[model samples]
Target: MLPGTLRAALAALVPLVALAVVPPAAAAPAPEPVAPSAAPVAPAAPVTWTMQPSSAEGPDGRVSLRHVLDPGASVADHVTVANLGEAPATFLVHVGDGTVSPAGDFDVLPVDEGPRDGGAWVTLGDVEGAERLGPGSLRVSVPAASAVTVPLTIAVPADARPGDHPAGVVAELVDAGPSRVRFAARVGVRVHLRVAGEVTARLVADDVRARWQPSWNPFSPGTVRVTYALVNSGDVRLGARGTVSASGPFGAGATHRDADRREVLPGGSAQEVVDLPAWPLLRTGVRVHVAPTVVGEDAVDARLEATAVEVTAWTPPWSQLALLALVAALLVAVRALRRRAARRVQARIDAAVVAATTPPARPAPPASSPPAPRPSSPPAAPRPDVVPRVTEP
Candidate 1:
């Protein structure tokens, strides 16, 4: 609600009502202004609004009319709240995404959810988070008379379809203190998002290299590593029912090569080089089957070429330059990652040592430690007169 308009509105109501009640005198001639026989007309009644705080402002509090949302646009409002009450009348509320409620709580829509799901379902405690927002929902409580500007925002995941969808922002007034207030007003936010029709993916591996590590080493032989890595590079995150199967050189064997696997997601992938029982690497000409996460997605018919794979010893003459280059790169990468891990572990150890060696803090002084009572000498002499005579008797 906006200001200044209310004052002008009250002013305009008077003239309009006066003109309606007083009509032009009928053609009857005035007969010496005789005493009126009818009762006087009463003024019009005042207009009553529910939460008529002395002041309120927020672009008049209305949603946008457009039906399109941008890639990462916020579906929130910049609300400016001020104290209109003589004392202080604060505006406190919480905001959330989903279907709007008549009483004003919010819930999520299925389409807004991610392929991977899990986030907090929250009822705002104090309206502090409102100072910041963008992720999920927000709840706010304001102090009276003092003005606060809160920006309400909405988020659209990049994967959302480009078409129109139904979504809204719901905000509610909550009890800020122990005033025992009953009900609070609510505000609604409308949003339309326009998501682009594109998703992106790339081969994340660097220059490919392969070599043979000692048999006891946990890693796959270099030849197997590079080949498997590329095949796994495409996508790893996919619907549960997806499948990726291959036969040819690589690790595919007579019975094993036919092993079926789940499909990967658009841009997620993983890789591995495993041990083989015989020289029968899944060679070229072997067939592969791919079932996409979605029925119509491009991954449904993934027919990849299976190239021949062979391992060589890492020692000088047997180890080819190609294999040596790969080994060198792997060694550098391993060293870097190990250093990073070592630093993290050392920091954690330092923290633990400091915690163990530090002494506990002493407590505050006791309030009742006071002056001690001293033993005093007994009365030196008894009452002289009566006491002495009684003793003798």
Candidate 2:
């Protein structure tokens, strides 16, 4: 009923009033501002490092430090430590005595044990603040992705023994701080220093012992077990390969077994055992032959010789013997039984023949005709007497 312009204005006002009353549909909670999704976090990296024999020119591709000198000689060398981690690392550089492990691998003594022999003669040069660590070792800091080279010296005493003195330079990583559990990593390069003097190479076999294990099967042969020790009695390291052989008297049923090659250090020995299949000869003779050779990459000026030792073992064939005895006993029993049966049969046949050949005894003649005649005379008298009585009846 109002004008069109006023009505249009009123209609627009009505919509505004309705929106205000409804509170603009609660503004949809502002969509929580969508909180911008967070980016993923990455894991931290591990620390690592390496140590190698190096020179001023940087890692010269040398695996170890080898030197041959006189009794009072001295030598100089360098080792580089590389920090391949994201932070700076400190390392301990020291010299240690080297020895051959039971597994034949070259190893160094523990750092805390220090060193003797050739290791005692070697010294590591000082680094920044090295006075805190003493004379034989050095502590140096290497920056991340960088390397530090340390110098070392080996001064042999005039009274040093004349032979090979094994030692090595070791680099150990220092922990960042005190912790409930500590882990330390170390690496080293071997130092093979030979003092000028006589170098002898000798390898021998000792404590040669053998045992024959007989098989239970009578038709199969048995095995011989040979055990011996390989001794390095000389001043140099030696590697050896050997053979174990067994034979009966006069070289009968000879068999041989090969032993694996092994390395032994000076004054060291290794025990070896081998089994060789052989025939069971009442007595078996076993011999061990070991051939010695030089070990290590270094050239040695010495003579290597082969050595041997012998032993004997008793390998009796008890099964075969028992079988033979059983057979013989059975055979004797059977023979005795056969003989007894033959004797019994012969006696029976003799009795049967005697019974068939011997004539039956003739019936004994009536021993007495007298007995019969007495009866007949009695009867005739009775009859004559009775005849007169019968006539009256």
Candidate RMSDs in Å, in order, are: 38.2, 17.6
lDDT per residue for candidate 2 within 78-144, as digits (tens), equals 7888889888777887788887775667878877887877789888876554433755677878789
lDDT score, candidate 1, position 308: 37
The window of 10 residues in a row where model 2 has the poorest summed lDDT is 372-381
Cα lDDT of model 1 overall?
0.39
Which candidate should be chosen as best, given lDDT against the real structure? 2
Residue pairs with backbone overlap in model 2: none
Candidate 1 ranges beyond 4 A from true positions: 1-67, 70-77, 87-92, 100-147, 176-185, 194-393
What lDDT does model 2 reach? 0.81
